[model samples]
Each structure stands twice: as C-alpha cells, then as structure tokens.
Target: MIDMDRKLGRWRLRVWGLVINLVANAIALFGIVAVVEGGSPALLIIGATLTVVCVAALAIPPRSDS
Candidate 1:
C-alpha cells in the first residue's frame, strides 16, 4: 500500500513538472513572437522572468525521503 502511494506521488510530481515546463515554453514563445511583432517591452520582460524562474525550478533536484 505504501509503495503504491509513493508511486502515485511520484507520478503526480512528474506530471506537474511536465505541465510547468510546457507552460513556461509557451510563455517564452509568446514573448519572442510579441517582441518580433513589436509588442510591449513589458510583455517580454515578464515572459523572460517567468522563463528564468521556471528553469530555476526545474534545475532543482527532487528531494529523496529515503
């Protein structure tokens, strides 16, 4: 039972990580497009900041509770 619970927890974590990464990439893409299309600089700044933050988040290793 405990093993099953651990597996589920890990699966959930992976799914969330994938989702976060996808969203971050989408934001970065939008930012690039906006800049190319002469959109606001603020949009680029916000998107770049979020992308950096997301990259930092993904760079951290998951904690092992062993």
Candidate 2:
C-alpha cells in the first residue's frame, strides 16, 4: 500500500510537470507569434497572466504525501 502511494504521488508529479511545461510552452509560442504578427492588447494581457501563473507554479512548493 505504501508503495502504491509512492507510485501514485510520482505519477501525479509527472503529470503536473508535463502540464506546466505544455502551458508554458504554449504561452511562449503565442507571445512569439504575437510579437511577429503585431499582437493585440488582449493577447498581451493573456500572456502576462499566464507568465504569472507559471511563475507561481514554480515558486510554490508542492505538498508531500507524508
């Protein structure tokens, strides 16, 4: 049972990491495109918000399963 919990926790971390990576990549891509294509204010705002979220995700420590 403890082993299963550890495995599950690892899996969850992997999934969360993947999700964060994908979101960050998507935001960066959009920012690049927006710069090259003369992006609007809305796109800029969205990009800023996503950047904050990504920063927060990295800054906050995850809770341990213990």
Candidate 3:
C-alpha cells in the first residue's frame, strides 16, 4: 500500500512539473519574441540566451531536498 502511494506521489509530481515547465517555457518564448520585435540587437541576444537556458532546464531531473 505504501509503495502504491509513493508511486502515485511521484506521478503527481511529474505531471505538475511538466505543467510548470511548459508555462515557464511559454513565458520565455514570449519574452524572446518580444525582444526580437523590439529591434534591439543586444536585448535580443540576451533573450535568446535566457530562452536556451530555460529549454535546457527541461531535460534536467528535478532534485528532491528530502
């Protein structure tokens, strides 16, 4: 029973994590597009860099502090 509960908790965590990640990626992509539209080379570069970082984070497994 305890094992089943643990499995359920892990599944929930993964689902929530995926939802949060997608939201974050959407925000980052929006920022990147906005920056590009603004027509500033330096800001566009910065935005692209941040977008890459955000995308890279999706591949990383989240750490548990427990």
Q: TM-score each candidate.
A: 0.58, 0.44, 0.43
lDDT of 3 by residue, 1-66 (tens): 011112344474445445666665566566677766875455445555655654554455545532
Candidate 2 overall Cα lDDT vs. reference?
A: 0.58
**Candidate with better lDDT, 1 vs 2:** 1
Candidate 3: RMSD to truth = 7.9
Q: What is the lDDT of residue 50 in candidate 3?
A: 56
* Count of clashing residue pairs in every prediction: 0, 0, 0
Q: How high is the lDDT of residue 18 in model 2?
A: 49
What would the TM-score be for candidate 3 when compared with the true structure?
0.43
Residue 32, model 2: Cα distance from true site in angstroms: 3.0
Clashes of 2: 0
How many residue pairs of model 1 clash at the backbone?
0
- The runs of at least 3 residues in candidate 2 whose Cα sits more than 4 Å from the true structure, single-residue gaps closed, are 1-14, 63-65
User: Could you list the CA RMSD of all candidates, in the order they appear?
Assistant: 5.8, 6.1, 7.9
lDDT of 1 by residue, 1-66 (tens): 122112445475445555776787777788788889988666667767777766666565555653
Compared with the true structure, all predictions reach lDDT values of 0.63, 0.58, 0.53
- What's the distance in Å from true for residue 17, model 3? 0.3
Best by lDDT: 1
